[model samples]
Target: MATEEVNKPPSLPPYPEMIFAAIAGLNESNGSNKSAISKYIESSYGDLPAGHATLLAHHLNKLKESGELVMVKNNYMRPNPNSPPRRGRGRPPKPKIPLPAGAVVSPARPRGRPPKPKDPATVAAAAEVGPVPPRPRGRPPKMARPAGAGPVKTGSGRPRGRPPKNKTPFAVVGFD
Candidate 1:
């Protein structure tokens, strides 16, 4: 019975529970970083496996992803239940206001610019004066250039802004 007891392996707590214990026991106001947490665990548990470091990293990532742990500035700590959930990228949605019973909600206006209202007097005048012809939909056909006209002269095709500096010797003014 004594030999059997001597040969038995030591029991270890779950990685998550060990992590929580480390954070709590270390009592860091900001939080404990990965190195600190790992050190604490190693010192607390004497019989950790050879791959303990990799295992710890995997569990830490899992905890952070699942919201079990909050990481800030590379340090890890438990999330505060009292704190509001973290906001997403953009501005938060506005809270909806409840309408009272029997309240009438107006329908949304049509999207584009509203048609211009006709003047009441013009409308009545038009009715008595017979219908006017509707204007053509697109720009009127461009007037034909007179037979004598040709393309107007525009100074060489260069853009019509400030001229670029001239490199020619003629452009240089001599004070002498």
Candidate 2:
């Protein structure tokens, strides 16, 4: 039994690898459709699991998502090495061009909207005497209250709670 097991062809590779092989074997320039890939797998690998179709579909989708395989018109093919990488959502970034020889590259500016440009004279003075300290982020701290200060009063002297409703009714004018 041990010898017979050893003689049996090496167990088939995992489903994904098997599927890739099937696609390669078909060698269709336009790429192989799911049905054709399934047929090739069935014929080339005789010991497929009972859920072979499901396994193939799942792995194909995964391969497509991971950029290993591309699906076009429901047919699967390996991605071309020379093809440009797929762009994500939103506008694609502009391509960077090579700088000419002996070009002087400016230092990269800091990321967010740049600070408003300072007057050149102020900038020159700043470079000689160290940079101005950055201002603190939020509203300036409230002016410190004097230790002896009392609650400030509003100009009108009326006390604060809601006033009671008036009990009187107004006379109504009727149509003649």
Candidate 3:
């Protein structure tokens, strides 16, 4: 019978200097992500510990957080200390105005989409058209009550259960 081999972590000398060297290489070139930085480390230092890539990634993130580096567009780069931080996407929300303490807040506008602005043509044509009644919640009341639905035999519309037994007691004849 053939024996299966168990995988083990690669054994190498603990040299963290390699990580700093990789960072330097990254800075020299255009900014790169974690994987590229790891490859650079491996290429520079022949073989490393099994989790060296993860270790490098941790150091890179730490550097970024500590302000040694800046993460720009998903790549780590040298921080431009002279430049101000850029604002993020989207318009800022309107600031809330402070309401006077005893004033009752008027009822909120109805939920759901705001009414579309009325077009001049639509407004002019609207008098001839009947105003659309607000829709009801459920099944739309079966548009025109489906042609031939014989007076609904109602009762929760559930299937009937067991039929009732014979109402009168059976009379037994006595045998002498």
Candidate 4:
């Protein structure tokens, strides 16, 4: 017995055309993200009929390679122009330092000690002067308090707990 051969139509072209058509539709509807495109195809074509992920991925890669789509830093894919410039995959750029108008910068100063104020008398005496240096960038290192100062107490004035000897012991219910 001879078996009959069934002829099937070739699958649609999986190229830039279909991808661009989808992208054009997205642009027309102002929905330009990968997830949006995925959702559109899934909804329009009914869940992609399995194994379509590879095809979808291929088309998306082609679209990206052809500059029709770009992936944002956040992993969202949109039109190339809409995506922000990538600042490398490493650490973010250091924030720019801003300076006030007419401000002068000096060399880094020693960690401790405030600069002495300039005096007219010292100037008249022809005292040698040195350039004042820049203060340490952020806050000054906290100073260590004197040892005898004891634990600092809050303003509530509750004598920061009495000396350990003054603490009264309470009877334990189980022991009692």
Model 2: CA > 4 A from native: 1-10, 92-176
Query: What order do you get sorting by lDDT, best first?
Result: 1, 2, 3, 4
lDDT of 1 by residue, 1-176 (tens): 99999987798999999999999999999999999999999999978989999999999999998888999999999999999877667988999999999999999999999999999999999899998799989889978767868876688877799988978666777797
Regions of candidate 4 where Cα sits further than 4 Å from its true position: 1-10, 28-31, 42-49, 73-176
**Candidate 1 segments whose C-alpha is farther than 4 A from its true place:** 1-5, 87-176
- Preferred candidate (TM-score higher): 1 or 2: 1
State, as a TM-score between 0 and 1, how close model 1 is to the true structure.
0.48
Among these predictions, the greatest lDDT belongs to 1
Each model's lDDT: 0.93, 0.89, 0.71, 0.62
For candidate 3, write residues 18-96 as lDDT tens digits.
5556667776565777677778877876667777767777777777666767787777667678988655569978899
Candidate 3 regions exceeding 4 Å error are 1-20, 26-30, 84-176
> lDDT tens string, model 4, 30-87?
4356566666666654534466667777777776665566655523245657556544
> What lDDT, from 0 to 1, does candidate 1 have?
0.93
